[model samples]
Target: MPNHDQLPTDEERDMLRGSVRGFLGQHIAGARTVDAGRQTERQLWKQLANLGLTALGTDPGQGGLREVVIVQEELGRAGCGSPLLSAALLNLSGVVEQANDERVAAVLAGMHTGDHCIPLAFGEFDGDRSAGRPALRSDRLTGDIAFVEGAEGATHFAVFTAGPVLTIVDADAPGVMIEAATAMHLGGQSRVRFADAPTVRVPLNKDGVDNLVAIARLGYAARAYGAARRAFELAVAYAKERKQFGQAIGRFQAIQHKLANCHIDLQGVELTIGSAAKQYDAGARDWHWFAAAACVLAGDALRQVSLETHHTFGAIGYSEEHEAPRHFKRIHLDVLRHGGARPARDELADRFLGGTPDRLPEYDLGPAANEFRGEVRAWLLEHWSGERRAAHQQPPFAEREYDRAFALDLGRTGWIGLAWRKHFGGQERSAFEQLALMEEMERAEAPRAGAPVQAAMLQVYGTPEQRRKYLPEILNGKAIYGMGYSEPDSGSDLASLRTRAVRDGDHYVINGQKIWTTTYWGEYMLLAARTNPDSKPAHAGISMFIVPMDTPGITIQTSTTMYGGTFANVFYDNVKVPAANMVGDEGNGWKVLTGALATERGFIGGGIVLKVAHAFELLCTYLRGVETDGKPMRLDPIVRQKIGDLAARIESGRQMMLYCAKQVDSGETPPHDAAASKVYSGELMERFGEVALDILGLEATLTEGSPGAILRGRIEQNLRHSLMWVISIGTNEIQRSIIAQRGLGLPR
Candidate 1:
């Protein structure tokens, strides 16, 4: 169970998911059974046992917690009222590895055949999973345990105490009574009062306790993930079918934006759970915190998604007859059952902020990439001083000399284009290594490399001449690039750009006006212009050229952005470019443009996530020392909650970026993947800025050199900068369109 790499292959996992889904659909995909309590799907239980799910964690040869996660998710989706989690996972899986013990062996063997109905009673009054502490006395167990899952159907109970000790007790033993308890989900819980119930102690070490808690948390998260997904599916279907004002409600931006946020939330939860499961399966010590993080993150996401989905369904959703209400109630039950999101988040914060100095989560980018991170981190430690960070704190839209110096130093070290060919002055590392480099640079608050667009595109689609002419200059920090794709009226509709490139004797004459060209101080511009006005599709006629910025008849007029960065309006009136400067085919600029965009989105997406992480760290540090109401700001419950929210979001964005990077390295075009990351990251930046300002209030507006300004007033700068991300690199609206069309395969 502790080796994720040894789990079933993707095809195998999918097959397992499909089989489980099919089974649940047949048996559990209807209205809930009206049974009040202690009811069991005896036949369905036998079928699950037949499917080998009951003994999944008994041996590696059978399966592990990964398989159990899949099964539980499917069960949740089907609204199955089964005790699989309590009996199979919590009890059987917990002791299966110690099968040599007579009791453990008997339980595991009988549980597989559905003959042993054992429920776990690990919590006391208030049912907080983390609140119980019990001690054995005179060969008897005395405690009032609450929220014992599946207790009404149990023949025996496995009770855990804070000594982290385990004890087994027969349900019929004297002085034990079970009271039927109401639950939010399909099954019922029971409050068990045991005064001097006969018990037998079971051995459990501290590590074993950690594993049990971690596995249980992961199980709940998986279940929540499935429930949230089902709710989302229902919402999406309803949005498409339900009409309002003579149109499907899904067509409205209000609904679309809400669903989009839900999509983002669930997707992030999916990745976080996957990461946590893998870490747990690998038996990594940090799995303890990661499991808790997963619980907190999933619970929060499920809560929002459940609310939105129910709202989407309107009146019908609120009725008990509808299925959505069941899922919504289940979401509440699942989350609160495991000490809820609040306590789970507090635990995560303690692990993060209270650990030893330098305690941080590992990137898990593998050995070579980690080595690269180490090298880059070491370099930054030596060079990125407090003064340098201060000097580089200018608006992202502004050109600062300190950024150039830092880039130059990195160039000299052969770090620029580290994943490119060594012959082209790159070290030929993996895409992940390059991402690691970018992540650290952003985390360090150092200047980012300017205009890697041309370099990145050239590595994939550039001609030999193009690579030789521009790549060396780019790697040496001698060439900066500005994009000349967006025209005044074209913007997101770049295929309809009016910029025309006409053939002349041995040259192409360019005529166009490009506005909002970022980093316009570059030495060169990748200008896209119409080469064939007669082509059937307008985009098919577009062509790209590498035009020198200082060419005759080219004028650059700088405009200041609200974020304090500078862009330019570049007018190319009859500017001539050598015919050889054309990139790819004369009328294939759309292909080149799109290819370049996928990579650019990755950089933009990844950079923003790390930037938020850096900003949050600063905000937390400030809160820790600053006073609110004569106490440290960190002591405020509201402030601590905000910090937790920010941390979860930052981690999600980080994982999304890693996924995008991995997609690129795997040779997939995955525009939808990049768009998802881009949209989420940009919007997350806006949220971070808003919350940081809320916490700091008027003090947050202080700029550089102000006495007691936080992070040199970068918080104010970030607020100004946040909106630009949503507008630039194709507006988030455009990205959502891409996601709907490409990722979800919805029609345009």
Candidate 2:
């Protein structure tokens, strides 16, 4: 009985974020300036209670899990320890909603008035917290529970016992001993010993135990995310100000790449947390899967960002005076606090592997979008068979007629320009629909709809005349475009090209040699050349035009690529193009080119994510069926760990792509985010291919047509094609610079 529509509006979330940020700044500024060991002041906790944050999520209008998370993140960023998460979110959240126990109800009611603080101690050394363990108990409980958060501040302890019961015990009750333990983070913990302590067992079931643990795990994840975010910001600031050889370290490729990775990790944590919160708000029973996923991924991210940020700061970060160690310590504690990575991975794998194959986490595009995905999937399953995939899968960087033919077939259905306006021969679909199309096409390994993509770009920056001349043919699947931006000298730096186009009455004569052009099969070349050679900045005076592929003086020499694909070294010797073919007014090509570049980066990135997902699935499926030494390879401990890690990373990239698409749909131009997606996914492709090959061993090296070639040698083929992902669409290195400068607000 999940309410799929229960998500908060963007405006409402923004307002909540602003108010929480403002509150933390006003009350916690002086506190953060001090060391991490000091506890959150009682006055500040009272102020939080006064604002009703402790009680905000109990009612629909007051907010829900998402609102609580929003407040938690800001509090964590401030390094403040008010026990809001441990006392309110973890201990009292579901209890207030589900139970009628008088003591529980009284504790919950008093929590909002800052008169009570109850800490959860469900974890024991021997048993799963959700499934209670054996303890010294006849009528009272006796055992030691480890890592009980907020233990030092608790007035009472909510302990889970062998009865799978939630027992409420006074902190100072007979036989109770609380040994204080030092934490690396802001909060305090204790080893709570119950030597036959008097206890009140509340009515609770197995489901209730699991729900409590899930709440605790998720709330801890929010705090970890905030700490990691702060760490990344600190790193970026240090990189910009800390001088290395001569310039700021942020200008160096090494630092930029690492910081960029930090950003990617933080993004994954944010998205996963948001998804889990929404699931909880909607009353989804499957919310536990998301909670587990978030904890595992967020833990790794927090650990990674903390380490990298510390590295970026050098020795100063290791000092007690710096804030980096505090965040670092907190990340270590949180990562291991709630069952750690191993157990979480096992939980996720059980859902995906032990049950139905359909348990694999696919993007839930809502009911309408799911219907659209089904329609598209059905069409693809019918049309794109094994044979079609083989025929169109002509490695990376190749342009095949078979691919174009398939695209033309899709274009006929009005699916090619789904994101374009309806009047422009498009369906005017939602971004989610477009994303669904991209993901399905990638999963099927179908022919890329590249030609129609250029047509869609034309809809954005093309002149009306240009659209009228070329769009119809493209819409009807007639014309395809080859890019003409990169020259022999320019790669990612597209503005420094030496190609020149001079006006000659009604035509412009073009002379340039373009390298790495993959659109040789297209009907037209979307060319970029300089019209004013003397313009102050090299980027200015650039012009874009549509040149006929069959124009007299044009020559295309094909070069074989490393990945078994082909690139066209297109040369133009005094080629003439009509003035009407120019995309925009003279000197406006830079704007047009950069705009198109952003779109291309965004969409190209979408495919890479799905490709990684497909590769991971293929690896899992192969290992599941095949055996070594009469045992399934999937059963090997090392193999399981490797695949589990890969699965998490792949899903992370998938979430990143979806978020970028959402930004585009909202009419925000996020070039940096688009670049981040490309950067993370491109490198991820390389890593996945490497790890998969390693796992599959020597037989995986055989090429297609070999007797025992695995997946028809697609694994080896992917190893070579992975380079194209990192190098093409803008090199991963270039994308890192974009992320550092634009996304992190660092200098170029």
Candidate 3:
């Protein structure tokens, strides 16, 4: 039923984007100047029809929602307004539902040629048509329709009314009055009043109207994304050229971080919109849900990007002559078209809170990956479900996150090294399969397995003997590793660690104190210490080693974490590790350490977000049966909105993870992308925890084993634990700096 193969390739989409962009570039001088009156708008609509864009919504062979998205985005990028949303998408969708009716068929045919301009007046400002629906008695329409776009020169009005019927009424028909309403960013909005106006009824159902609105919302979101992206580009260009204090403003970390944040926000908006379009094209059952989620996220993220873009540009950006203002207007106005994000959020809340509770949509990660996901799901069902999972989950939250027996069982299946290379004793599976494995593991709430970072470092930089001894140990669950990069004072600024490892005859005598050593109980530590302390760059003096935890001088002082788990302040006093255990050449530890860190951050990004998703799922499940003050919790408007917001953000994080995995599959070690993923996902976990508590109230703060605790007190524990994700694996602030420097090419 879902023909993903029919979807456009990247090259095809690129070509389409180029063509649309080039066309817009030629016609529209600027966004603010695009509203040249009704006649000019009509002329542009005809041009779009000639280019086959007007037919895209009606003819599957011409193109589909994806093509529409490209056109809309280009329109927004150029800061030009078009009737694509109104005439092409909304009205055309309604007409197609009643194409067998001669009047509707004629209207649809005229629309393809850009000869008809029938904007649908189906809803109020808040997207509720039912509230003030026109009386549709005796085949006549009566009442006022508000917030109709492109109504200035429309050939007819497709009015949806109280009987849930669609009627085509002539703009100048008896008792019909069209009056200019308040201006929007794009202009050409009006109110239409009909006092028993004569009309032709086109048979259509509420489903048809819902579909029409969904299409319009998606189109508007694309436009918002395009506008936000253009604004960000303008800010970046200005930052590169705007000098301050004797250097480019972009060189400043403040500017860099601001622009980097805009970049991340744009990524979320773009990815969500793309996924929604693809789902719509595939005829997926949950396509509407995807559409709503896209709108909600785009409305929030793009709006923020637009605002931050101006913030980056400073005073000059506020000028109407500058490009930023137009895009800002476009993003704000376009996103709020179908009652903005609120209505979309309400739609999502209805689905999530009203029913048996549906799971998040599963993305199509390709055939091999799809099949592999199924296999992983089945395997998880068999190996880690019911009583065993219950028993594993009974411990304090942090302690339950990993299990040796489970890790050993999973390691025996060879899945722990799924994405490692072949020569290094791995199956060398695709990254998507690896993602599938991680996703399924998180979905099943299974314990983590193996030392992936240590295994990766050994595969790349370890000596031959080291690899032989250590690789299998990590792969077969025979060993685990503690990271020894941070000291009491050197956490985020890891290169500044005071750890020292002086080379002796055949061993490295290490002396350092590492704090927050999460795996201090493991067999070995992947340690980073300064070897050439006098080296000019400071970081170049570092070296990496594998130190056995059982070394005579090693002392572990464990401290309890706020999340009820323990980490150690490990003191390595005259500990002797064989020089043969060194991961890479001495004084090259920065590269080796960063390489391992990159891998760790990539999965950490994925792992943290997946954990939030699992927790969100649990929260949703709990809310479905909850009641307060005599009403269902799910029925509470505040509860519905919060859950909807969480669902959309979680989806955005999921897309970001998939994007990072895609980069890895393409042979790219995307450190910046990984950083972006890490930053967004880590922060999202924090936000989700807060929102869970807000919705669940005080009971959510209860601890494990407490009387009448909610979700075994996991919600509050997660709220506390979320702080670790943002702090561990490098702080979010550090990740933002990486994104600025590496992702956006901002000056350090």
Best by TM-score: 3
Q: What residue runs in model 3 are displaced by over 4 Å at the alpha carbon? A: 1-3, 90-98, 101-103, 124-143, 170-178, 181-186, 193-198
Q: Which candidate order results from sorting by lDDT in descending order?
A: 3, 1, 2
Instruction: Count backbone overlaps in model 2.
Output: 0
Q: Point out the worst 10-residue segment of candidate 2 by lDDT.
A: 30-39
TM-score of 2: 0.92
- 243-291 per-residue lDDT for model 2 (tens digits): 9779998988788889988898899888878888877777776777777
Q: Which is the winner by TM-score between candidate 1 and candidate 3?
A: 3
Cα lDDT of model 1 by residue, 375-473, tens digit:
999999988867776656544436552367777777787777787777766888887898788878877767666456788778766789988989988
Order of models, best TM-score first? 3, 2, 1
Alpha carbon deviation, residue 469, candidate 2 (Å): 1.8
Q: Tell me the deviation in Å of residue 383 in model 2.
A: 3.1
Candidate 3 overall Cα lDDT vs. reference?
A: 0.83
Q: Model-by-model lDDT, in order?
A: 0.76, 0.75, 0.83
Candidate 1 stretches with Cα past 4 Å from truth are 1-12, 33-39, 58-61, 88-105, 125-144, 185-187, 193-196, 203-211, 237-256, 311-322, 355-360, 382-397, 421-426, 532-536
- Specify the poorest-scoring 10-residue window by lDDT in model 3: 123-132
In model 1, state the lDDT of residue 653: 87
